[model samples]
Target: MSAATTAAGAATADEELRWLADGRRIEAIEAISVSAMARRLPALVVRAFRLGWRIDRGAVGLLLTCQAVSAVLGAAGLFATTGTISALFGPGRVEDKLAHAAPSILVIAAAAGARSLLGITIRTVTIHLSPRISRAAEAEVLRATVAAELTAYDHAGYNDELEAADRGAEVCVDIVGEAQNLLASLASLLGAAGVLTVLHPALLPLLVIAALPQGIASVHAARVQFLANRATIGDRRIMANLRWYIHVKRNADQVRSDTMGEFLLAKYDQVGRRLDASSRRAAMQSARVSVIGAAASGLGGAVVWAAMLWLVSTGRMSLPRGGAAVFALTAVGTSLRGIVGYGADLFRTGMYLDDWSSFLDTAGGHRLERGTETPGAPRRIAVENLGYAYPASDRKVLDGVNLHVERGEILALVGENGSGKTTLAKLLAGLYLPDAGTVRWDGRDTRDLDPHALWRQVAVAPQDYARWPLTCRENITLGQPTAEGDAAVLRAADASGAADVVARLRRGLSTLLAVEWMGGEELSGGQWQRLAIARAFHREAGLLVLDEPTAALDPRAEHRIFQNLRAVARERAVVLVTHRLTNVAVADRIVVLEDGKVLQEGTFAELVAEEGGRFRELWDLQNERTGVPARRTRQDQRTVPDQRTRKDQRTLPVREDEGSGR
Candidate 1:
């Protein structure tokens, strides 16, 4: 086949698979009779029962018991009904007929009353079990999804499956009830079948034949409903996301600022139109199927009545027997129709449950391995030829990078935006595994150590740190809950210059941090950054990685943090990743990275001493912007050009200090 044709065929195949997942397509009703559904009914019924049984075995058993009692009562009532009718038609005195029917009248009354009581009991049991099923299913889904590998969230397939599984959890409550009702219907059906056979064996086949068309219709309607559900799910998610964007407190400011209301509504309407159109089409198709089934059912009923009348006239069946047979046939037909309807519901629910099953299976494959080994506090961390690329991406974020940091030393990483500074720091922090090389902590590979154990020894504050909506004390203590009170918290705050921010709060540490909530207060960008820094400091881990830690801090606050750097490093290693070159002056070592590769590594003074190196050139450019001349000796000053000549030389803004790959 041509490529275009092949692609179309593949698309068609996927559509077919989705249809088959829920059984046959709606359009196949004419090609496949009700007999085809018989083969799959047993499996769907069993699965539905298994699900209900797992949620609440007691409820399942109670429901089945009620169904059994109802079925037995219904059968007795049918026979009593026949006995009463036969006595009414028998020859004798009026008194005699009344006496004979009176006993059956009481029997019928008892059976009817018991059936009603069982039905009520069934409803009560369902009420008790529905919420339990929903809660259990939701918990299971959340447990798997929350623990799934972080990389799984990056893929669209995982997101779609998650949405479907969430919907399935909600439907679980109804599925259990439907399955129970199906069981009850089957019981009623079997009871009616036995009655019809006892009255006259010839009538049993007619009951099955009468139910075929309605069964076909039920299957067809179910398939149409499933198709509509699957088709609109993605669009519904988009609409939901748009609604959240429009209505949530967090996005309200931006929505109003950018006047995004109209744009978002437009997108919502666009998806809404497609969803409405699909729903209308599905409804029309389902209605047509129902009409066809109803017409066929009417014809079958007519044929049955005609056959009964013919038999009575021919004397092949007695009047009372024929009457009872007609009643039994009607009951059997009703029960069979109910069975088919309930089966359709189970089939539809099974498709949604399939989504849940598939999500769990896929998540299992991607689950992060929990290592068994644990290591002591690292004396040194080494990155040996480390490389990393994000999932489904071709370009590497860190390429063949090598570095090391020792205890009680400060290592500063300086790089421009998108230069792999954060990615490298994350590798060193054991948050990600290298694609091609190893990160070793005191000669033990990070992959060999339990991730949870390794994470306990490290702390990180990224540029976009979380601002938890909690009390200030809770936020700070969140980093180290075991720390004893305000003293330790205030100490970390003082180190990061966050103490001043806390000192100004209305209630100090007791103040709620979320202004959006009632009786809560907000923090400015700089204050939040200080709090984040305080959190990291409170961790007191063996190693700390702070990415753009001073991004929101003022120059004075940044200077204070740098000045306190020596004291913070006295007990553990520190790695600072920032674009601000001035922050590196306090570091014992500095590494410059460009385009995923190490450009230079040394102390600040050593790098600045090189006349034409990349680090020295960057330093000179920054100094020129700040009106600080590069340091020079008396002999070098004598060689400098005169002021007027220098002014002319500056016209083109040429940097004579620009290095040529030295």
Candidate 2:
């Protein structure tokens, strides 16, 4: 209703757009928003009560005091009117009654004008500050999200938590703005109550009693909605996913390929139908709450109205007082109903703020602590009896697995697609911690080491590269910062063999990744993979772990990259996880994995020399698949075999004794 209230909702959509840019379900939003609101509630309430003081607290107080004085003057003017009527027939009224009444009426008019101006000025201030609140709240969401550990996102409830947090952040402005309006309404209700008290004190208690049931119902309705939001959070996400499947560009190919475009459409329709049904049910319940509350308030007003007419008939009250009494009761009754409605609105919004606060409370465990020591020398990363269970899974992916990498040496970790090679790499890089045993950096446990600090010295080309929507420049720069311009980016691009891809873009390095916003063409998977390799190269960390890094490249391009890797490895320990033995032939040492442990380790010559090892088996399979001979000679392996010695994987044991988290 006021300018201040209007401002809170105006810039909200833009603020939410910035939020949506993070991801489909923003993990950081809740910690940022609701937590701060919960902390600020007391202050907000205090501000609400003193809200009218914005133009000048003293000036507003002076204005209100004058209005009170003017109302008293108007009551005196009423007495003047009554006396002037009786005096027309006899000497019942005071002299100059009309002239005295005129000044009282004029003072009332002047006070009313001052109050209007104060209201407008206060409204303007509120409108101006609304964006500040929204942005501040939104900033908190971003801070908490980015600050959280990557692994915390593995949980399913986090998906719901994230959406709820955004909802809370979006609705918080409405809550506070409406709260201010509610307070103003409360003031009017107070004035109306005082007027009613003067007219008939007997009806005052009855009106309050009549309002209680509705007030309770309003609060109950708010709780119901909050619970519904909590319950349907899963359904809402499913609906969103289905809706995207049927409409979003990314899912279009799959939906059509299965020719279940209509089936996907039907699923979307089903989810939509359920959502509609739920919303309608909630609306009906809310309407019932409102209706019952309204009836009670109307009854209270009717009681007061009936009493006034009776009092007038009994010659105990004047007609003018009776009319004033009617206005007072009706206004007070409506205000009662409004107060209940506003209270419900506030209650629901309070939960949103609660959701925000609760999310923030969870931020500390996820973000890296600032004071952790950075590793002095990049050392061998060892997985000792390492075992992992997926979040909420009963079975282990990497059970009692032992693996080791020495400093400045390449270790080729090989396994079948689902045999946990990538998972082991993630554990080694500190993206994930083993459920049991240790992934130690030099003899120091990874849990004791700060992940952020470790990440500074480690670069990983994950199974999937993060395809940032920013320009190719921003995308690569995200892996590292400080350098800018096409020249710096081109160098990194060239190193990762992505320079040609960048050269083909319309704006080259400056072109945006997405086709929707900035006018730039998109790259294919192979091209994006090259960009990812450039990003990893740009990181320039002491430890480089590439998972299937050469999957998208041709044999010739792959060979060229392997040459680049040998030069890069002089300063850093390189771990290549790949199925292509032909590509891994360039590694300084090769570690072959079967199930989750190392089956054998040696130089390519030595491992190939062993007649019965897993490396030889894979080599033969690749040779057969590629139409090349991987024929091995016993004399070729003789001296190399003498140089290599290894241990069994069966001796590794599991351990999980540690504090959960602070």
Candidate 3:
């Protein structure tokens, strides 16, 4: 097997074992005991009921009334049946017995019919309420996920918990049915038990004994299945991700170009096989337990029947009472089985709901809890002794970084990859909180400001901006349109050079940006980047962070963007991060960073004139690559000879030769 497959399999096995251990702990708590189930049953029922009540209170009330009425009718039907049996068995003329049993027969029919109607009503209410409950649960999960801090995504534990909560949301609807089933079963059990007690007290205990073995088997089987499902969670997630990669239109071209279809399918198959193996093992174990329990149940059933025979054979119980006992015993047994089955199902679903509830309460333990102070658009954003390290990482992405940008100033951050340029810009924009020091907006710390309110004043055109599958207008406005509306969108589009792109669209501003939908169209990489830039331009924000804002643009569009940037920055503090040193000329000040620390800070002319500096070295190298003469101060122009040829300029060394004053 390939290393990827081998590693996946190993990780899956380890997770499966861990989940199995958790299942064992649950099993210990829920072992076949009346006290255990009784303790758990009330809480699970109340939780389900609370959810149902929240969704549709009328339906919840109707469901409860129907179950209660159905149980009463069931008990009434059994009593009428007993009366009919007693009349028929009495020592009397056949015609007389038939006449005496007539009313009892009608009563039984009425009770059965009423119970059937109640059952239908119960079903209707459940159907009406289940979907609403499911949607509400899913909505709550989405809200919690959205409310969580951005840094929450950096931790694997948070993601795993999120997946579990999502799964819980899906199964949340099942708890409604399970809770109702359990209630109905309990009602039936009580009515039957009561009837059996009236018939003869001995029969109730005997019926329970006969049903106990099967009840235990059902609970054990459910636990096995739950454990199996828990074990396969990681494998299932892997399959889902792999399937998306293999099936999505975005990856379709690459899958075919790289001949990756078979490789992806093989990994999928590997994960599927592991899941199948666990399921099969669990099924086999459940079957073994079930077979043993069935045998024990059969023996217990025979003992109950023998006891009934003894009661009848002795003059202790009448034939009519014995016949009623038979009916009551069957009812009790059915109810007991229903209770065990539904209770097990309810418990399983409750565990899933617990995950959902826990996530909502803690948002995977990463809920945002910033201050209530909502600051207005910042006049000056400052970073003082800023330091940051990503969750679970020892290496700092930014450390001791101090910079400031005021309104109307364009500060350019230039750095190589992993040199913390983007991280520094994000800190300036209040996207992340520094661990060591403060990022302040107009004198107020960002940490002391409401995150949502703070973010409203910050606009970002990131390197990897989203290609939102929305209308062109919506994409530009980001669903938060200003009072100017389409006019604002158009102006921003024009500024970002996306006006021409929008004009070519079938619906102009109304055109959907995804091809998967009807009447929608896809944009080229450069076109998409323009829309991204337009979104940033459209936002009326105090701070603007543009990271590689023109990476995908053509030379003309790139030049246009930088040429107009200073004008755009007149009302906001613009922090631009780019590797293209040529673009830094647009900024009032340039800060060159290397290894998370400032290497140089100056104007484009000053940095380029400082010979042997990192910025000067980089500037010369870029000039060499493009066969352009390096920017020089008037003093340097006088000291160095002009290169004679384009070829010589292209081959110019980064370092000037000392003592060779050409």
Highest TM-score against the true fold, candidate: 3
Candidate 3, residues 466-508, lDDT tens digits: the string is 9888999999999999999899999899889999999999999
lDDT of each residue in 455-522, candidate 1, tens digit only: 88897889999999998887877845754678888888999999998999999999999887666988
| lDDT value, residue 84 of candidate 3 | 94
Model 2 lDDT, residue 457, Cα: 79
> Using Cα atoms with residue i matched to residue i, what is each candidate's TM-score against the true structure?
0.81, 0.78, 0.89
Candidate 1 similarity to native, TM-score: 0.81
lDDT of 2 by residue, 1-662 (tens): 98877887685644210111224223333233323433544555554324335424654455345435444443443333333333333333455555544554555466556556656654665565555555556667677787676777775466667776777666655654566556555655676777667766766677777777777666657765766576566677887777866877777787788897878777667767777787788878878977886687568657756777888789787665666566666666777767667766765676676667666767623554433656744767777888887887776778888877776788887767667788888888877877899988888887888767888878888777888889888888783564455566677688778888888988887788986556567788888888888787777587889999988887665766777887667777788999888877888887776666666778999988999887888788877766666776543444243322433323222234323333
Candidate order, lDDT descending? 3, 1, 2
lDDT of each: 0.82, 0.68, 0.86
Which of 2 and 3 is ahead in lDDT? 3
State the TM-score for model 2: 0.78
Q: Is candidate 1 or candidate 3 better by lDDT?
A: 3
Off by over 4 Å in 3: 1-34, 626-662
